[model samples]
Target: MEPTTTTPPEPRSRRGRRPHGKVRRRLAGALALGIGLLSVGALYSVVEPAPQTAVAQAADAATIAKGQDLYNNACITCHGANLQGVQDRGPSLVGVGDAAVYFQVSSGRMPLARQEAQAMRKPPTQTFDPHTQEGADNLAALGAFVQANGGGPQLPAATGEALRGDDPARGGELFRLNCASCHNFTGRGGALSSGKFAPSLDPANEDQIYAAMLTGPQNMPKFSDAQLSPQEKKDIIAYIKSVSDGNNDVGGSGLGGIGPTSEGVIAFVVGLAAIVGFAMWLGAKQ
Candidate 1:
């Protein structure tokens, strides 16, 4: 049998060097797991979002919700469900800024009574008054919503008297040069190119005035903070108040606040005239 004696029966490990089925299974499983992990890593990389973008999205969503609530409650009637505005009703508020909203709502010009050449200044609705806490919050939320959707001018944090300055004389000069064209030198609203006209500053508060300058509602041009410093804006407010009723007096005794000297002179002249008139009357009776 030619030494064929089973060839000494090949060793178990040396017979064709065959690997165990368990080893093949393990290798296949490991390869599958690695492939799956690589796929998962690539997916995560593609889906990951920036931290700031996520936060901003969340904030915008919340603001939009709140604004939708407010708009549904008050603005939907004329501004449409999506703020597209209605024909002959209200204009679209897409790009209008928080400043415009603050100016109109704070001054009670919105929720218009009827479609007219302009929205006249009146008493602010109970919900939109900037002076009140609730109204202020609502205004901010509403503004955020509008901004998130349309992107318009933004009002500064330092509103109202925070922007007021100390020099009324300078403010007066600035007003005469810049503001008098549209808003009369007296601050009473004036006519405009279109039906839209300048709303009177008499009804506007300090914050409202600042917002108006910043946003330039209607035909008014936007006035950046760079052009008019905070101090200058405050000074202009002071000048307006000095001329328009002042804080103490909505209608003071001073005729157009011609200063104390003029008032005193007028008073003296009137008193002197009265005394002379009495003397003349007595002489006539005699």
Candidate 2:
């Protein structure tokens, strides 16, 4: 039939042929590659997590250990080796927090001068003899040690402007109840027993006030956040600011805020002396 062989299907050139075997191999390879990639990704997801560097963990451990040692040696007698505190000697320090410790110890009020009606701030009875170093290292060691044992509020690493409250009314109320007992309603600061006094608030900055409250330096009661609540403390600070602004109408100097007793004494002495001098002059002239 005109070359009836039909050209034998033109010998099916390799280019036109499907090459089924090669196609199957490529498909299998692609599937395997995808599975391998997925398996690797899954394994990585399981193993990797948020990182906590080994150095940080080690430092924290060291700090806790040092704190435990210090508490045992310096604070254990009255506070108890476990920080449960002796029956009447000291209060339990479980959650009192680091702020309390810093305030009392740094201010030289702790390691108490002696057991009395209150613990007073005085020169540190026992100085931190860091036989090894000075400055930050010593402070870090002490701070770490106290922090480990626990007793009071913690000073924030960054006390921003947020530490200074915006609300003065609340600050005033807080000041009256918690601070005014010793500081006076006017924030003039008042006498405690002995030579110790509350001192004037005129010079105190936000940090000093916060530290004073947290530490309760020298015979001052500890005001943990649990006790005073941060909001109340802010209000008290506002009140102190108001009083310190000098709202008095008198044209003369206010001798701090010790009040009329001293003022009256000065007036009597000065005025009476002037009157007597005038009388003597009149008699001499006659």
Candidate 3:
């Protein structure tokens, strides 16, 4: 009691200043924590996603989540929230696997421009191109999300030239037997009934051809491993490449590779023109 009486009252400013300093320190710590959290989130978003060797590769939750986001934004309109597909707009993607996705999307045939007899290839969506890591990551994520919902045909581990086989001769036989009717003997493509047509293979790369065979995009029939062995598929690819690269155009100009009908037409036109000119010359001489 005596000490209390002797002690002067603590200054109001000092008391207030100490409490204010403590409050400032707490606020500063809170701000630092918030910044740290933001930095971590930014880091995660910027990191590159891994590429898949096979479409069946299991995806982590984060990747699936990212894919889900992409689907919701770009695909939900036609493909639906669950990928069941919106009737009259898009087909059900239940059994269509990543192979289909890669074929349709990577080739820019999907996210359809409009209702048509066929989805034609064009420049791919900026996010789906496989040449860039970001595009590849996005494509992988979207494919993963679709695959997670329903497993389907997975792309092979091998890609590019690795998919080519040793025997172009055998490949030519297979191609003639299975693909020539629609794709033409040289893969130049041809008209089908209605508005549909077989798209030319000139623009397609090796992976695209493989994916098309695996998924049977558009009117093309799916060639399962049971129907065509992997080696056989490779051979077919080699044959296609050989023809596509002009290596097999040993007969000179392929004349658009439209086959003998075009050659016959050209021959007839040239012969007709020559005969007409000859007749005119004879009349002039007479």
Question: CA lDDT of each candidate?
Answer: 0.78, 0.67, 0.87
For 4-106, candidate 3 gives per-residue lDDT tens digits of: 5477886677776898899999999999999999999889767734344233354467688888899899888898888899989987788888788888899
Superior candidate under TM-score, 1 versus 3: 3
Candidate 2 residues 171-220, lDDT tens each? Answer: 87777767778887667878888667887777554554676787676667
Please, what are the lDDT tens digits per residue for candidate 1 over residues 40-145?
Answer: 9999878887687889988878877897789788988888887788988888988877778778877777878777777777887778777789888788787777
For all candidates, the clash counts are 2, 14, 0
Off by over 4 Å in 2: 1-52, 125-152, 159-178, 191-208, 214-254, 259-286
Residue 219, candidate 2: alpha-carbon lDDT: 69
Q: Model 2, clash count?
A: 14
lDDT score of residue 67 within candidate 1: 78
Between prediction 1 and prediction 2, the one with superior TM-score is 1
lDDT order of candidates, top first: 3, 1, 2
TM-score of each: 0.62, 0.56, 0.75
In terms of TM-score, which candidate is strongest?
A: 3
Report how far off residue 239 is in candidate 1 (Å): 2.3
